[model samples]
Target: MIGSFVLLNCKKNREKEVMMQLKKIPEIKEIQCLTGPYDILIKVESPTIEELNETITWKIRKISDVRTTYTLKINEEATDCKDDN
Candidate 1:
C-alpha cells in the first residue's frame, strides 16, 4: 500500500461541505481541519501509484470548492522503521 498526506484549500466558507464530500471517498482514510494557508488535511492510501494519482486527480480534485491539493507521499523506507525488540 501507498500512503500520502494531502493538504488542500477550499472555497471560503465551504470547508464543512467539502469535508462532508471528502468523507465519502474510501481512499481518504483521515481528514482534519487546518489553520494556515491550507483549510483541510487528509491522509490517503492506495495499492498502486496509478490508483493514487487517479484518487488525487479525479476523486479528490473533482470535489466542488476544492481549490488546490499538495500531496506529501509517505516514504516507504521510513514507514518500515519499527521497534525491532
Candidate 2:
C-alpha cells in the first residue's frame, strides 16, 4: 500500500464545501481545514501509484472549489506504530 497526503488550496470562501466534497472520495481517509499556504490537508491510501493519481485528478481536482493541490507520498517504512494507538 502507498500512503500520501495532499495539501489543497481552495477558492476563496469555499473551504467547507471543498472539504465536504473531499469526504466523498474513498481513497481519502482523513482531512482537516487549516490556516496556512493550503486550506485543507488530506490523508489517502491506494494500492498503486496510478490509482493514487487517478484519485487525485478524478476526485480531488474535480471538486468545484479546489484551486490547487500538492501531494506528498510516504517513501519509507515506519519505525513506530505508537501514533496509531
Candidate 3:
C-alpha cells in the first residue's frame, strides 16, 4: 500500500471542523491535532498514488476553511528503526 502524511493548516478555530470532516474519509487511518506551523497531522494509506492524490485534492482540500496543505508521501521500501528491535 502507498502511504503519506498530510500536514494541514486551517483557519483559526476551525480545527475541530476540519477533524470532523477528515474522520469521514476511509483512507485516513489516523489524525492528530498539532501545534507550530501546522495545525493537524493526517496519516493515510492507499493502493495507488493516483488515489492518494485524488483524496488529497478532491476530499481533504475540498473542505471549507482549509487554508493550506502539504503532503509527504512515504517510501515503503525504507526500513524503520523500530523493526530492528
Per-residue lDDT of candidate 3, residues 1-85 (tens digit)? 8999999999999999999999999999999999899999999888999999999999999999799999999986466656655
Candidate ranking under lDDT, highest first, comes to 1, 3, 2
TM match of model 3 to true structure: 0.90
Residue 53's C-alpha lDDT in candidate 2? 88
lDDT tens digits, residues 17-70, model 2?
Answer: 998888888899989989978999999899999999899988899887899999
Q: List residue ranges in candidate 2 displaced over 4 A.
A: 77-85
Q: Judged by TM-score relative to the true structure, which candidate is superior, 2 or 3?
A: 3
Q: In angstroms, how far off is 54's CA in candidate 1?
A: 0.3
Please give the lDDT score for candidate 2. Answer: 0.90
Which clashing pairs does model 1 show?
A: none
Best by TM-score: 3
**What's the lDDT for all of these models?**
0.94, 0.90, 0.94
Better of 1 and 2 by lDDT: 1
In model 1, state the lDDT of residue 39. Answer: 99
